[model samples]
Target: MRWIWIDRILEFKPKQSARAVKCLSLAEDFFADHFPGWPVMPGALMLEGLAQTGGILVGEANDFKEKVILAKIPKAVFHREVLAGDEIVYDVELLHLRKEGATVAGKVLVGAALAVEAEIFFAHLDQSRSQQFFGDHNFVFTGELQRILGLVREAGKRPEQS
Candidate 1:
């Protein structure tokens, strides 16, 4: 099953930065096995959330022309345990964007407290090569993610109900 970790895209600035949020709940599958008595959100998943956020930012920079993939994670540090009901905000800033790859520094926050932080790197595959290797389906930024992005942006533009 394809997992879309982040719940919503709160803000996005093309080629620069983006912020996304995920609301954790007890019903999450990982909670069952992560810790039987005390459930905690896995650090790896949170990292993935950050990567996904940054990856989308990078993908949008070139209008989704190249297939973006997480190349490497130079660093990652977890400050505290993330529990169910916590809302994690992933803030990612593009450090470098090159023809072949990109890098982003990111932070995952629970409210004002920092939960995790790291540097994520992404590589852009040649369009023609990727299509041949992966059968032309964009694996990284699927329509599901893009749809959520558009919906969130549109919601932000709408007038709030009085």
Candidate 2:
């Protein structure tokens, strides 16, 4: 499944921070199986959402030269459950970045309340290696992600400089 965590980019600061949103709906596939009677978004998927947002920020910061993959998730905490009809606003800040890896701190907010917070880590790898790691796992960027990237670029007011 092509899981797109971010629905839109509300704000973006190049090499610094970004804010994006994800609207949860009952129509989403995961909700169908997560729980029958009472559905709650999975914590792992929440982490995935944060990772996706943070990875994009890192990739954009580096001009997407190397494919940024989630190498490890050193720390993650779920403060609350995200339910259908909730809009999760994710804020991510670049904590550190180097040639081989990067770290980001992210928080997911449901309205004004914090739902989840995590410190995510990513490793930069050659495209070929990344492809191999994914191993036929089809990951396609949804239109939402493209739109967010557009907004991020616009907000930054600069083309991605490698």
Candidate 3:
């Protein structure tokens, strides 16, 4: 199954920034093992949410021609624990964007309080290079990714509002 951590795209600005949210539910599988008595969202999963948000922003900035992959996480910090029923708002700002890769500064907030912050770097892989290694069907939801991020308005429609 595809692991889509973020639930919805609240807002997006091409080549600049994006805001998205994820609501953790009691049925989340990880909660069973993360902590038996006191369930909490894993820090790693929080970072993954941030990366997924930033990765989508980077990919959209390039029209999804290049496969954006997290290469390095230069910095990450968690200020508090995230629990089930918590809705996390991820705000990511692009620091730089180039042919090779991109960098972003991100923050995760629970309501008005900051929960986590990170600096992420991602490498852009050429489509041909990726296809050679992973084959054509590897990314079954490339279009879906765009749709989830609000990059694509509808089927056969041009990406809306940049």
Candidate 4:
């Protein structure tokens, strides 16, 4: 099953940055097991959510042509626990981009407070090698994720409220 952490894309700027949010719901399965009564969103999952947000940004940077995978996390620190009913935002910026890979620095924000900070690095799979195994189709940015980018673009068209 495809695990999509973020609920929707809030803002997307191709090759530059992206912002997305995930609202923790008490109904999420993990909560039931994480703690019998006091549920908390796992920090690793939070990082995964951040990676998904940054991954989309990196994929869009190359027009979704490269197979982008989280190669390494050089840094990540959790400042606060995320609980059900809280909304967290993933704000990521493209720090470096190249043919081989790219790096992104992001912050997980719960309102005005910083919940988590991380630096994610993505590596592009060798086209010739990957095609033999994964085929010509781009698997990194699937239909669901493309829809997210589309959603933000559409939202951008609406007249702003003064």
Highest TM-score: give the candidate number. 1
In model 3, the clashing pairs are none
Count: clashes, candidate 3: 0
Which pairs clash (backbone N, Cα, C closer than 3 Å) in model 2? none
| Cα lDDT tens digits for candidate 2, 1-162 | 666767778787778988888888888898999887667988888888888788878987876665677888888888889898888888999999988889999999998999988999888765445656665433433345556688766767766698
TM-score-superior candidate, 2 or 3: 3
What RMSD value applies to candidate 3? 4.8
Question: How well does each candidate superpose onto the true structure, as a TM-score?
Answer: 0.92, 0.81, 0.85, 0.91
Local distance difference test scores for all models: 0.89, 0.80, 0.84, 0.89
- Looking at model 4, the pairs that clash are none
Task: Give the candidate order by descending TM-score.
Answer: 1, 4, 3, 2
Q: Which residues of candidate 4, in runs, are more than 4 Å off?
A: 127-131, 159-162
Model 1 CA deviation exceeding 4 Å by range? 127-132
Q: Please report how far candidate 1 places residue 5 from its true position, in Å.
A: 0.6
Model 3 alpha-carbon drift over 4 Å, by segment: 127-141, 151-162
